[model samples]
Target chain A: MTTSSTLRPGVGDRSVTDPGPPAPRPRGDGAAALAFLTPSIITFLVFVLAPTVGVLVLSFYNWNLLSDGTFVGLDNFDRLIHDGRLLGVYGSTTYMALAILAVNVVLGLLLAVLLETRMPRWLRGFFRLSYLFPFVVSASAVALIWRFLLNKDLGLVNYLLGLVHVDRIDWLGSSAFAPVSVIIVNSWKTIGFSILVYIAGLQSIPDQLREAAIVDGAGAWTRFWRITFPLLSPTIFFLVVINTINSFQIFAEPRVLTQGGPGDSSRTIVEYLYDRAFGDFDLGYASAIGITFALILVVLTAIQFWFSRRWTFY
Target chain B: MSTATTSMSPRLGRLAARVLTFLVLGIAALAITAPFLWIFRGALSGSDAELYRLPPTFDAGTLTVRNFGRVTEQVPYFRFFLNSIIVSTVVTAAQLITCSTAAYAFARLRFRGKGVLFALVIGSLMIPIQVTIVPLFLVMSKLGLTNTLWALILPGIFSAFGIFLLRQHFLGLPRGLEEAAKIDGAGQFRTFARIILPLSGPSIATLGILCFTYWWNDLLLPLVMISDTDRQTLPVGLVLLAGRFSTGSLGTIAAGITMAIVPVLVVFLAAQRYIVQSIASSGLKL
Candidate 1:
């Protein structure tokens, strides 16, 4: 389809082909284009861009929700540097995010490879859909369902554990297991997406390449590592960037399940930001933390993009 | 190099590979399915006894709709449901109108600053919503939209990701149909409305479904914006219900969760094909 479109002639193509219409002039396109774009630009600028800039400006002030602004440049950043709990929040969020990313990428790749092999087509579709169902459900719903399944006394998980004579673990209550549980639930909800991406990547690899590897007496493991893995790197790179960003922004799951509970065991940075701004009524400080978090994300994303060019095939 | 050895080894390897693949995939399927089964059984369980019983029994007599009734009675289930519907619908409709127009411009029109503007829109995708929340709330408060449905619906109406997705779809559309309409003396808006919009039904449906689901299941924005109980969306309302009914039977809370989840699940099942395609395509883009 793309090939056919590129071959066709149109006003757009003519402009590029002949250079007859000057690029700078409106050429009656400006009004029509502006008419088409105005609503989105207005809403985006007002709702998204304005608030984004406002938050950055708000971060440098000491204005609480009640009082007028007093300049407190760098105080919030200084306080953040000294705050031990903030460090814990950063540690917990990073650890959980990375752990979940590793698990999901490995598991998703495994599933994709298996399903794309000589498996029954129907079974492949069924597994794909079943895995994706949890993802399609709301985060709140997923947390609620899991909370029921993992309840200490009346939960089904503990009940099953009893049958195996294993002790019931406080999945959400214990500091040791709460983050682990969040990671597990998050991976479960999200692994399907990574799997699909891997599937797409797997499908794009030409069949002749795999056949040649097989004809050369390469075993499945060797073929996967030597041939498929390299081809799958672009998908892996995409998943890593998206998953990292999402992990840092984790909010709904912990909010529903733990409330950063049992002594702030699952207090992620975003949740801490929420607590400060809303719970503690420290809007100025929260804005400062949020701005700092955003900057960190931007830098991380920039680094990812820079590094991706080296490793990501496409 | 021996023919007999090569033939026999190939046969044996094929059988072993088949068996191993089945074993691995079966275990993965089981692991993926366990939580779903657990949730369903708990939802169907009659008493808390069945919920905690060893081996997790699913007795026929214990399964009933009593909990479903309790869910409605314990919370303002209908009100929250209506709130979710209204917000999701408004947001989806507004997004379709605003995003399609912007997407059309990016896809079809030649204008000054097009490259810069398009880049700005795409760059917004990397900006986390958390960064914008503080001042967004301030804006909402100043507009007197706090504690109202507008706070939830308005902000979501112009998502950058939505515009990007639609623009990609529109750019791939055939130009012949639109050219035919233009030759008939149709203006750009008419050409879009008559030709491009109809041809883009599948993409439109995908966008609508995604936007609806996101708003329907959203918890964070509603949590921050809404202070009034009556205006709370379903997720927020359910959380409040769980807190209030903390001392009550677990059945009611489970039922409320189920109630909140079922309608969306039904919608998804009905639109499973389009929804799945959207996820697959969008997954690749990400």
Candidate 2:
């Protein structure tokens, strides 16, 4: 894959072994490169870079979407410190995110491991694709389907539960149940992705190691706990980081299923941010929340990366 | 006799574990696929009451396609579907063009501040949409593009992830073809368009499908940007439908969801390998 020779200036004309930085032919390739780069650079600046900076600046102002914003330094931050609802939102968001992460990683690993065992080819393929089916569907659509299926009185879930003499549980209405319901629905839609990733990670592990462990008379639990787990730590680390970032951003499930109802029990950060910016038109406060959440995520991701060195194998 | 018993017990235990694993996996797969079948079944039920019936009837004779018609008649389902198609298609195309070109520049050509510029591009990936949606909303409002499809399309057109993925693919390509093309008097753009892109179909398809699935299924952007019924995407439309009609028209709501997900499910099944590989690979490395 080395391209150092091709990158050397005038090397193709002279010889093939020269190594240097790329100098795309002297005939205005820089201009051509600029031409190639301009579209992405412009869009990235306008939509990503500038707006990122703008959100931070807007956090210091009082803009209600209709009028000019007056600079009101520290007021938004002051309010953010005291906002009781914000505290609950963060709590529930973290709770649900962690729950979803646990279900995804653990169940995903279990399913992937089981699938790795000897099975009929069609059955294996069926299980693999079945788990992934929900991942392809949109979150909102999945939520809508689950909303009907999880309804306390008439939904099929309760009906099935009733068949076993279990009482109906208010899945979407009760504050106690809303967050759990959200975790269930969200996990249902997402755990498949984790399973697929784990399967791929399992495939990458050499079979000889597992066979050698079997020859050593190590049982299934022993083999997994000792050999497979450590080898898959890097993959686990990757899924943890990814799932943490995505889970904290949960929006559509709670939005569609509960509408962040029953006293903000299931409200996620993004949904709350949406409510402030669009629903209440409290753009400044929303921007402050956004900035704070972003900062927290940055710190959290850094902490995870820092911790990974101690845990991740590679 | 004791030695035989010890080895036989271990073998029996292993066999039992294998059987349990097979049963557990079978049940889990059934549970996973059940909801999809449930949605499909609900969509076809002839009567709304049938959805609520205890030990729900599985009779095929009781099902019909009328609920699908009812879904469309009740709302602008087709309009939202059309909007989704247009927005996702345009965004995917825009990403392929913008990202691949930029990736080619990063991977093949030399430029000033290339390292810093590329770092900035990668840095954008860490910034979530929630952090920037406020100002983006204002920008859309200022430009009079609020409640329009362009509001969704514009922000989605450039993906830092797409650029990163494409650049990785481009960097792996052998330099012989490009150098020979250059020696034959082909321009950089000509060589890229003629030689590089054709060889990079899998990476391009991977990016395209990823982008399409994302924009097609995205909720928050459409939720914030498009309010007009005529402009809403399918996810937003499905949410609105559920909010308004979910109380009585369970079948109709299911019909709408089925319509929303079926095409994606079909495409996923057809390209399951690519979709799965893309997510797994992207997860591992990115």
Q: Global lDDT of each model?
A: 0.79, 0.85
Return the clash pairs for model 2, or none: none
Summarize candidate 1's per-residue lDDT along A1-314 as a digit string, tens digits.
22123223333443343343323333757756776777787788889999988887888888677876788988887888898788788888888888888977888898888787676778887777776777777788788777777777766677778888989899889998888878887887888777777887888888999999999988777789899999889888878887888888888888888887666677788899998988887887898888778888988889999998988777
* Ten-residue stretch with the least lDDT total in model 2 chain B: B1-10
* B11-121: candidate 1 lDDT, tens digit per residue: 786676677767877776676677666655666667766655666666787687788787777777899999999999999998988888888889998889999999998
TM-score for candidate 2: 0.91
Shift in Å, residue A70, candidate 2? 1.4
What lDDT score is found at residue B145 in candidate 2? 94
Where does candidate 1 clash, by residue pair?
none
- Report DockQ per prediction, comma-separated: 0.40, 0.46
For candidate 1, the docking band is acceptable
